[model samples]
Target: MYSHWARFAVFVFCLTAPLSIAIAESDTGKNNPANLVGHGGPIKAIAISGDGKTVLTGSFDYSAILWQLDNTTTNKLARRYSEHEGAINTVTFIGQNSRFLSAGDDGGVYLWDRASDNLLMQFKGHQAKVLSLAVSDDGKLAASASWDRTVRLWDLDNLKPLAILKGHKGPVNAVLISGAGQQVYSGSYDGSIIKWSVKTGRQERPLYLHGWGINVMKWLPGKQQILFGTVNGDVQIFDLKADSIAKVLIPHQRPVLALAVSGDGKFLASGGGDGLIRVWNTADWSVVEELNLSFGPVWSMVFSADNKKIYYTGLDDYAVAWKISPRKIGQEVQGKFPRRFQKLQNMSLGERQFARKCSICHTLKAGDQNRAGPSLFKIFGRPAGTLKGYKYSPGLLKSKIVWNEKTIDQLFAIGPQHVTPGSKMPLQKISEKNKRQALIRFLKANTQ
Candidate 1:
């Protein structure tokens, strides 16, 4: 769900250290800052291989890093790849996870085969910095857009220039390869998207999509709906069902740097100048998750094939990954919140805050293992004295206090030490009344 407050946080983040220059046009503007990942360098771009076994990224530092993606990693399993002489803008894993490709500020494209850990080939053809790139599914062709105002096609087999697709008066910002493996979509400053036939190296569909230059178009994994990440921060969903624009998803505060369709195509991931990753549910076009990064505009992103994780990059030359698959589901129940909690939305906020602050010490629901603290899922209305197989302070056992709103508040604010001097609790008083009250009310309402 999109939270106005969360979105506001993203807006502030963009202003401080913009993730991209394209964020000037976000209309819907629903971003979340709570997803922040505290880090120094902001990421410029990120990519995951077809096998979902590896991730690659490039940054302002003129370097790239590869991650193994899961827990199966160690110092030897991960290593930094620094072959580019300038800031790397884009990278992609080649067919069958055999090789990798990168385009950068050097106005050159370099091919790398990790098996040899050596530069396989370098195509120094573009006159300007390459901003975007795409590789066909069969891995036979490569298309790149450059600040030089041109899109160049390269043959992966022999590393030769196939042809240069021109006509955009300004720089070409983004490009994509369609799922059919036959077409190439390029978005340029000319405010149009041009489609090229990959076979004969000819223009297939020209002057289509977006009134202004389209920033990006991502083909969903399972459906024909193509999602476009625009400089305007509006994510457009083109549904084959409607044979047109099915929905326009604008939820970021800045120009979208990248548009990634989940491997299953059930969700859409958008990241860019906003330093936030917004995941929109394909069924409703509503944002379901907002993951925040601490710095840099996300220049690009890619999802693991199983939809289990997400990887993105920022301008700061860093790459990061997040878990997204086997989606975490929270346990929900009825009548667990106060009647006065009239604001269902407030309850959600309160729940989130509670989870953040208290989950470590106590269990609020079933199946959540107790750490150093006790379970509070049903603590209200019951005698607060004792539970089976638990340790209780002698003072608390003697005080015989009941678990109620007032008692809970006093225990938290005044501290268990004051209420029951000999209590075993190791804590201090909670200073804020509102927070204490929210916690007390929440615990009480869920007791039943």
Candidate 2:
């Protein structure tokens, strides 16, 4: 049995921030500022402290930084941990804020004593990247989901492997432990959700299927329901007792990547590759707010302890926090670029078209971090994979094509797959010749 208030406490502690906080005033006269902005690469994971005064963020730069949260002043980075050899995927604060665990692509989990900034212990068992982690309410048991398609249980009290629960056919992406620490739930890219008994290491019968690969999931506090975000961009609520999907939401246009529920069980937030975050009223399941992040796909999101704010990471290096006000529903917040680049805002028709379409995944400025796509700075004459620091697909890396006007036009005319087979770029084909020419013109203008 789960107590709502107690589960709320656990939710606050488990869900997971830093940079010069820029104050972006909304047109509604609301001051909704981006709370933190200092990661060097895309942020992969986020967790807030039990006290709500601190935040932890994991990034593709192979580091996790702890930040002090202050509303009145800009949040400051408190500590930087760089022991991991690969991109960090999941981070969680255990007990209070003093102890924390981070899992990375290196297939290792490291526990740290935050007060002393010391590495307390390291646990390794998974054969592939660990995608998600959950700690029991008592902080005695830990569950980790990995791309190896197994969920490993750890005895946190003894710092040893307890059990390995294997059943999923594809990579396990999400895991959650019951408040009492008796049961564990895991979701996988195979589209199945499996429940396991922590004590017996036995899985329950009758798997719940999502029809699409699950990307992220959350157990509702004080309720027998689980919220799942799927690769098909559907958000499904599955009832544990009824063992079926009670509700299905299609709010996003692309794959859903992150999900978070309010600590008090009043609201639910889901973010997706469509660059939108939708907030729903839990009582009626009606959408109360929709935030357009405009940065690329959102990879992670977490609600503030008070439930009045949401901190999320997207394709950008910086993790952003937005203020939430139920009274001000349907309000919009526009993205703020640096003031020094205001002249770039005077876009021609071609540039405006590119800004509306291509700007979400590609930055025009030089020296900026890569987003979903590589920066387009000086892209006109560069080779496909010549942009340094971006992880290019094998096909693009081995290609001999230079990004001239004709090649750039061909890319959108037939799609990246046709232009360069096996490229990881999403399937987006701009069939209109004029549109492609306009886009190419904008690219040439910006790159020059």
Top of the candidates by lDDT: 2
The ten-residue window of minimal lDDT in model 1 covers 332-341
lDDT digits (tens) for residues 77-115 of candidate 2: 888787675678999989766689999777898888877
Candidate 1 displacement at residue 194 in angstroms = 0.6
TM-score of each: 0.60, 0.68
- Give the per-residue Cα lDDT of candidate 2 at 372: 49
What Cα-based lDDT does every candidate model obtain? 0.62, 0.75
TM-score of model 1 (CA atoms)? 0.60
Hey, what RMSD does candidate 2 come out at? 10.6
What global local distance difference test value does model 2 have? 0.75
